[model samples]
Target chain A: MRAANERVRVAFQGERGAFSEEAAIKLLGEEIELVPRPTFEALFTSIDEGASDYILAPIENSLAGSVHRTYDLLLERTLHIIAETIIPIAHHLIGCPQASFDDVRVVESHPVALAQCERFFAAHPHIKRVVAEDTAGSVRRVIERGDPAYAAIAGERAARVYGGRILREHLEDHHENYTRFVLLSSEPRVVADGDKLSLVVRLKHRPGALYYALEPFARRAINLLKIESRPVAGQPWQYRFYLDLQAKMGDPELDAALAQLRERADEVRFLGCYRSAQRTEKERF
Target chain B: MRAANERVRVAFQGERGAFSEEAAIKLLGEEIELVPRPTFEALFTSIDEGASDYILAPIENSLAGSVHRTYDLLLERTLHIIAETIIPIAHHLIGCPQASFDDVRVVESHPVALAQCERFFAAHPHIKRVVAEDTAGSVRRVIERGDPAYAAIAGERAARVYGGRILREHLEDHHENYTRFVLLSSEPRVVADGDKLSLVVRLKHRPGALYYALEPFARRAINLLKIESRPVAGQPWQYRFYLDLQAKMGDPELDAALAQLRERADEVRFLGCYRSAQRTEKERF
Candidate 1:
């Protein structure tokens, strides 16, 4: 751990005012320094470059499934998942101070952001959607152009950062939409207790291989929160299964189950044990 | 079924020469009529509008996980999945006939397409990448403008349809990129023999719910291909599990497995039973 006087340097992918940045502040509080990277590759390499003390990367979205790049990178890079957090993804319609919702003819954002606001676009058929590389960057462009006809759909913090007016609020199609992010560091921190566990395992290619692998947890009444099997690169038709279980590392039953899993499966890897973001009180928008 | 001479009308969510259209033709053969819908909502509602006989929608990608919109829409709509197909996703950089690769300074396509060719972008630092609404539409625009400096990354079929020249081939970072699409019709087709099975189940909220649910298949030595649990909308925390298994509809063991599954789970719905595209030979790129 660093000194109390020195603030934590957190790195996230995107422009200054991104949803990832908002999540980092909400989880780490207002005293941390934010370092923004332009791409996923850059964000993952920031820790190695000594640009930041920790990296916050999105693992999955409520509607969208897993973020494949983050999952693959977590395995490839030598980093530890210290903690995870979730935040509501709310996109607001931002524009120049002179512009109102009615004056907006074109809205710009990342394609995924544009896709999420389909209902808003459907309601306003005359407005056109243009795609940008980043959501916050689009707001900056609109503010720089000072065009009443141009607007952007992005997080609320973007409007504050760019000094743009909020033309509309909550343009996202789903209110329950949330993205889960994980904090990564080079060294693993000692945890006296953690409620969640994540692991990756490769099983023998057979019919009952997975069933037997899961039997250890089932027999002990452990809850398997999620299971995802990704194709192993260079090995066609083979998969590496990722499982999220509701058990801590220090538990005796958990240790016994892992011991049984190691004997049953071809290979097993323990990623981390952390508290579930679900256990925390959700922030009301 | 209609007469064999008349063409089958299939609707897909994209422009005329999209990868969806290519997959539909590759699966249904060239005699079918292609109906291009502008959005996923439009594509799903095409049958209600009496615009098409069937809809071909993408379910998942080898790189990306399941298409969430398609999975959610599949549950909401009354359509039945009759057939499924997998096709290689080969992105090619297309420019005007007069332009050469050296003259290109800008690239445009769907955001996902641009992202898949990350290595290409990394190599050509001078080429600026822009995001368009659709991949095929980008190629059409590039051909219409006839600018040497502007090019679009899309499938080879898009270049042929738009009369553009392929500036570079195989721009994807991974060579094994493939997309799986499912054919949905209002009426279910009768299949005398099929090897693959897809079903959805709502499990009882318990610790060992999923493990016990898969016990029947394990006991019968049936292969469980994939399992995905999606959160039940509005129900919060609860999930509806979707499973893909390697068993046919007429098998005695499969029937017994289904009987046991129904007894163990709250609800079970069979999505489809058809031949998997994996059994077919992959096209050499």
Candidate 2:
């Protein structure tokens, strides 16, 4: 309905200042439109509803591991991953503009966010934790309520967007927290210089089935970036493995390896082939 | 310290009638003493605190995927997984004895349990959803309040323990929902018939390092039950892998494979060698 030169509408879960929104802005320029959805279900179906051009979804976190619901949704939908981006997660305690760190007596955020800042809570034994649906939304509510005793844990961007103040910074227990996000599009994206390939393969139930499937890539010295085994729904014990491999697009050896792999694997679906985000420099501290 | 014949105390996360309690009873039998801890951290440290002789924790769920926190805690401690058990997860809508299905206006449970009953919630849009810290705790509170408008979602055991009535049965969206838990002990468990081995390995950051590491096992036709790559702390883009392999304890080929694998891997820690849970029959519906 719109020209290709028009701004792309990127859909993400949570409020405007959520991590997914920041990732979309980093990958696509600031000119893109941010479409915020209340839930992952709505975010995944935004393209079909003509509300978005692309969906940026968090696939995994360094500490939290894989986002299972997102992976299951990817399998349910026809969307394809075209690119990916990784961002550092730094949780900050935000409050009203007039609020100070010493005034905070209650904190609220998503359960996972609250759990990550256990050490901070341990230090402040009197502070109570309450759960909220969205991290950024909590910041907005805390500021709107204008209670100096209440604060929320979220990113620094959330404080700026919602006119809140940063009462304290970096409340997470681990400094290595980072989340990986994938950009999904309805139409297939074929990058000529793509070097990373993600595939989901289901093998027949037999001894060494996975080992045999990897032989083709292993013999060729293809680097295996990651391998995750997810249980196949309705079938106990059996699993489907998701592999991330390092190989340039259109490489003859990669083609040969895939052909050889097809014989051993019962089903192999190419989730994507795109440039990896590993080449991107880390965020400056 | 008590003798071996004394009742073994098992530490698990959550209150009584929790899934972990059921798992402990199934693996160690009814003679064991149940020690409930409020959090995973306390449960993992129970042995050092002299509160329990063994720890039982959920490692994976069929629909939800692996519990990353449990894996991380395993790496932090020196505990060894001695055995595993799988249990079916069937959520039931529970209410006070005087409450009926038609009188319920709200439901409360763990977020995971609430998420699993999407179909039931969608059918009853008027019923508000609330999040609770524990599944059985929610049932206990709802029944104690004796509110006909409030209900909790939990297992059948929770209803029996809390004296709550089951308003609805099998509220989970999928019939295949199940959870796998492992029995952990401070001392190594030697099983003469052990057929499964788990190892945490760190390999050099090279293209063929992982491929070569798997060569020894693959050549011996050893089955890889699972493979999970976790990001190494403080090292971005680097990973430490946890592998589950199928092989009898002290098998000549398994020994040869490990000996060869050591040369390729930078570091290898044997988590445990125990019998596989797949040999156990599935729970009858």
The numbered model that scores best in DockQ is 2
lDDT of 2 by residue, A175-243 (tens): 988888999999889977788999999998877777788889988999888877787888866788888
Residue A262 in model 1: shift from native, Å? 2.0
Q: How far off is residue A181 in model 2, in Å?
A: 1.1
In model 2, which regions exceed 4 Å deviation?
A3-6, A282-285, B3-6, B283-285
Candidate 1 lDDT by residue in tens digits, B153-272? 999999999999999999998887888899998887756667888888998888888889999999999998877667675443457888889887878989999999999999998888
lDDT of every predicted structure (CA atoms): 0.87, 0.88
Q: Which segments of model 1 are wrong by more than 4 Å?
A: A1-4, A235-237, A282-285, B1-5, B235-238, B282-285
TM-score of the A chain in candidate 1: the value is 0.93
Q: Write the per-residue lDDT of candidate 2 for residues B100-189, one digit (tens) a residue.
A: 899999999988899889899989999998887779888999999999999999999899999999999999999989898988999998
Write one digit per residue (lDDT tens) for candidate 1, span A234-276. 4444678888899988789999999999999999988888878
**Candidate that would win on TM-score:** 2
Model number 1 iRMSD: 2.4
